[model samples]
Target: MNPLGPGDPLRLGPYRLVAVLGDGGMGRVYLGRDGTGRAAAVKVLRRELAYDQNMAQRFVREAQVAQAVTSMGVARVLGAWYEGSWPWMATEFLAGPTLDQHIEEYGPFDDLGVRELGAALARALQDIHAAGLVHRDLKPSNIVMTSSGPRIIDFGIARPEHGLTLTLTGQIPVTPGYGAPEQVLGHRVGPPADVFSLGAVLVYAASGERAYDGGHVATVQYEVVHGEPNLSEVPEPIRVLVAPCLAKDPAHRPIPAQIAAACATSSGTKPSAKKIWQLGELAADIKQREAAAKQLISVPDVRTPSAPSRRRLITALAAGGGTVLAAGGGGLAWWLLSKDGGQGEARKPSEEESTAPPKPWDAKRLTASQYEDGTTPPSLWGPQEGPSPVVVQPLPVRDLVLVHDGGSTTLGAYNVIDGKRKWGTDVGSYARYVAPSDELVVTVGPVTVGRTGRLLALDSATGEKKWTAPADAVHVIAADAESVYFTARRDWRQSDVSLLGAFDMASRTTRWTVPMPVECTLVTPPEAATDSGRLVLCGQNGKVVALDTHTGKQVWTLPRQAVAILPIAPAVSKGIVYLGGKSLTARKLQSGEEIWSLPAKSEFKKTYGGWGAPVLDGDALYALDGEEISRRDRRDGKADWTRSLGDVLQQLDPPVVQGKTVWANVHSLDSGGIAVLHKDTGKPAWTYARDGSGGWGMAASGNRVFLVHGGKLTAMPVF
Candidate 1:
């Protein structure tokens, strides 16, 4: 379980939630206390599920069965609140390691251990079946090992075997690799299905991985229905007992009672419950962590006589009333002041900020190599493997082109002039966004499952570790010489609110955190709109706001628009912020007034890479619409020259404009290359052809163009 983050609820229903136990797509599990001082685990369902009538009904019915089970091997459900706006259930809290975590950490169980575990599970399932319900979703994670024995939990998909099914064929929810063929085929499931699941579970306990490949759902279903089960590593006696339980036909599978008897008969002396702790230290670690986190939180005294009044206060607090439970007291305690309280009137955008000198396009200058054909600077690195390749737009600092290799999990500085790696550091073993500045290189990777990602800073020249701090969940929106900006949520697609913050490296804290007025639930962080040292934030449904980075204050904001404005990075040049989204927009940096805006000419492909940010050059603003790049007068948005690369370069990097020449990187493998266009006419001045191996986005300094293609960094001269 992760420590409770800011804004996580402290109380729900009649229970005072103390610590987060786990979180899943369905909801959150929190350790809590009831009004009687009894401890329990409370599960709060996702709000979106409230709108699904069918799902809500199933949830309530399942909760009843969960609370009704009397088996010692099952965690008892205590209470549930289904009719309220937030649906939650309280169950007897179990402190132990999940079977999944245990097996993952300690490897597979021995043959004797497997038989013992199988016997315990068989008896548990038999009891559940006697209750007339089928635990349709039984996986390793659902089984908790206590000092006494294995206990089943999470009856989310459980239902009476004879009851009319709420889910239809192919729609029934079951964890793949554990579900029976009948469940996968969406046929009516019964106790025999549990037997099949048990067989699969035992197979996993004896061997580390699952019986059927779980890479693809459809493939897994097909295999579960027809393919032979994988038991190559299973030892003899337990293997003999498991083979018959996984029979293709449910009727052929042994009953739980018979299976248990057979396993026990052949099994040696049963292992003691005290030895269960030997599964690994995972459970112990969780308890230790939970104890530490609880030290900072004020848990509500649910057993107090005034509990009803306190709960009402908490309900009100959720609506912004600001009540807080006092530590060590059973009575109502502190009231947190509202953020709006005492804050003076909101600041208005001033004309000075709007009329400030339009900033020039600020980017690294790459000296295009003049070395002819031999100048295809040698690649600093070689090929690596992984489905996710680096999103190349080489960041050049001095003579080094900073690049990341996701396949190799390395971040390095390559000499732009020599193409030799100067220095490299292991960033991590996952996809990360690398942002470069004059002094530091910052990289943010995906959230580490239960924990947030770290913002790692490396010295620009040495590639040596500078500092490490917590970062927004996935990606960096923008980075400057002082701080890194990012969106807070782990997955943009799963969040309603994204926290936008600036982390100050020196202070090791957030300079400021403001909730973006948009829903950007994509995997990566939404790009920030910036110009002239000010940040113009884009939100879905037409919300755009500008902030002054120096004082961490809002400058101006725009009203809602008809379209979502979750932009790529907004470009600022000549005092105007050019925003990209479903449409292109130009707004005054100071006053948040729209200079001009245009809807996309056509839909772009669904890929994560370059945002369609407008490119600013001299008096013109260049923006992408479909496959075309159009230029307009920056002053009045008057039309200028427009060009199309036919059907090529759909994933475009922002074009770099210098004097009368323009350079843009093309993303392609077979035909991808650089195209140079005349600034005056929307026609190509010349083109540099590559075997589609050149990276997207070329860095220009003086007359040199630096590009990273196919994991190699190179520099070439702009003729």
Candidate 2:
């Protein structure tokens, strides 16, 4: 069964074995050729490991998750399948070497190379963590050096902790020296644990030594638990950063994103004057020395001094010098003449050239006047007509505010920063949902007539009534600068059906309504109207429908399964819609086509199902499920970073990012408190606790954050 021996069949599956790359605790890895003759390193599970059901399941799951993560720095998972009794996973076979092998053959890396390696590994960890899986086993042996950069391999043991436990009584099996204390104790393990391992790996890679210098496993574990790491060789700037990553308590450890940012800041090389001067001088010296050496080596004869010979040499030298001088003068003249023959010539600027004045600052500062009018309007009011609320709610605007208090309806102009009372009218009691638009706020409630709901339009500023209508089922409301759309559902004796309808804001007319094939929930509005003049809608049943806003015609429909859907409103940035649930997907608004999708962490499969829509900012989409918030690329759904906020209080508010900080209203499960985070690094900025009480439903603006509790609002500064 060994593929490395001579005369044995080198090919397995689509790859041909070339040589034994190495052997590890799991099995032997073979260098092999693919169907196209490209090289790959395939790790085949040992028979002992493969036969163990638990280990095999973990291996297969790791392979599945590893394949879902897409990053050039991480070794690409090419294929995984059973070949006899062994299961194997193949990755791009790099020709360089393992970090371990490199260190063994060449000692430790230089400071610059070590920092570069740290940054690359940190980035790779970011990608892996973003996919919701932890590289539980990160060491020098798992990192492969390549021409491009480091490639992280061996996800055979990586696993999500969603439904899994760290240890059963004392069955801890992780590498003793690299494992965090919580991991050692077999308690809960999260991304922080992986960060601890990464810190140990970096230390080993930089110093060519283990974090602990003990001889016994117990001694190493003791050192890891109680002793400071031997980081004498690590650069000063990185020492402080890596220290936190090795914290014994997972809660005290820095997240992978923070580690990466720190590594980036420390490792960014800048050219210096001394280095530049040295390089220039070295180049000049090398050129002069080479010329002198070449002349000496090329000459074949040497002559002793003689009067007649010297005179003849002098005469010959004088004639040669005159010829050389004339040629140089003529070439210079010709170059000068050629400059004037160009199509156009630029004139020198005058000494008194006027410089443009500095451009005016465009960013608006937060003014006290914005929040000074602390007057609270009554819950019920008639329309009075004024300017609508400004349309800025992060980006990829999703969600409209509509309130059905009892049956008496109140329509509010909703935005990320402010929500204003637009209008209030007596509809009925027992309202369920409210959907908002620039000009109208629709209030819906369940009724006997197939879950009937009511829709109303009001003057955005004055709260004056515009028009009203009855709807079947109301789940969401989407709007542009000019019009509004809503999704409604109707239930028959045995089946439930859904519909999407659009209404003109100026005319107060039902523009159109189209029936849906199945009962579905609306994710968000399209980023732009399609060529067919219709808005796009994603349903809960995984169908994307484009319906004409002016007519009841179906423009196009496609099948898609998303855990979450967030519509991008026109008032915000356009051309992109955010989706997250089980998996994250971004779609182009114009064509109802998927742009990209990223795998969501298994832990988020449940909590994120009920979390708010993903928030979009520029090209980044932010989504939080439970204690983790991930920033992903809006174009290709690639993860930029993932940060764990830790489990806090119940009924926690969503996270808001401002400047370099992320503010959130958290309630501690043990007690009531609030936790704040640095957005760029995911490190805890601060934590504030309310006396004897818990808070919920928080909102933030500028440097201040607000929390509503028992009919009272508490505002606190973030800094």
Candidate 1: 10-residue stretch with minimal lDDT:
324-333
Superposed by TM-score, candidate 1 places the C-alpha of residue 589 at a distance from the truth, in angstroms, of: 1.7
The lDDT per prediction is: 0.60, 0.49
Q: In order, what is each prediction's RMSD in angstroms?
A: 22.7, 28.8
Which digits, one per residue and each the tens of the lDDT, describe model 2 over residues 241-313?
A: 6788887778888776676666656344431222211222122222332332232222222232222232332
Span of ten consecutive residues with least summed lDDT in model 2? 325-334
1-719 in candidate 1: lDDT tens per residue? Answer: 23355656677777777655555556667667766766667777666775776777676667777565778877776777674566777776654456775564344565556777888888988888888888776678778766567777766556888654544345547777788898877688889988998898988887766788857887887888999888876757667888888888999999999988986784443333333333223334334323322322334433345443433433322222122212110111122222232133212111112212323322233235422332333322232221125554566676666666445466666665556668866654443444545677777643445566667777887877787787544556676544567666534345443667777655777777776645564343455644344666655444566775544567676554324333455676434677665566776565556668776665544442223666765446766655666777765666677788655554434676654456665544467766667666776756655566535545665345665556555555443
Residue 177, candidate 2: how far off, in angstroms?
A: 61
> TM-scores across all candidates?
0.41, 0.36
Misplaced by over 4 Å in model 1 are 1-388, 406-408, 428-437, 445-451, 490-497, 538-545, 548-567, 581-583, 598-611, 649-652, 658-660, 665-671, 691-695
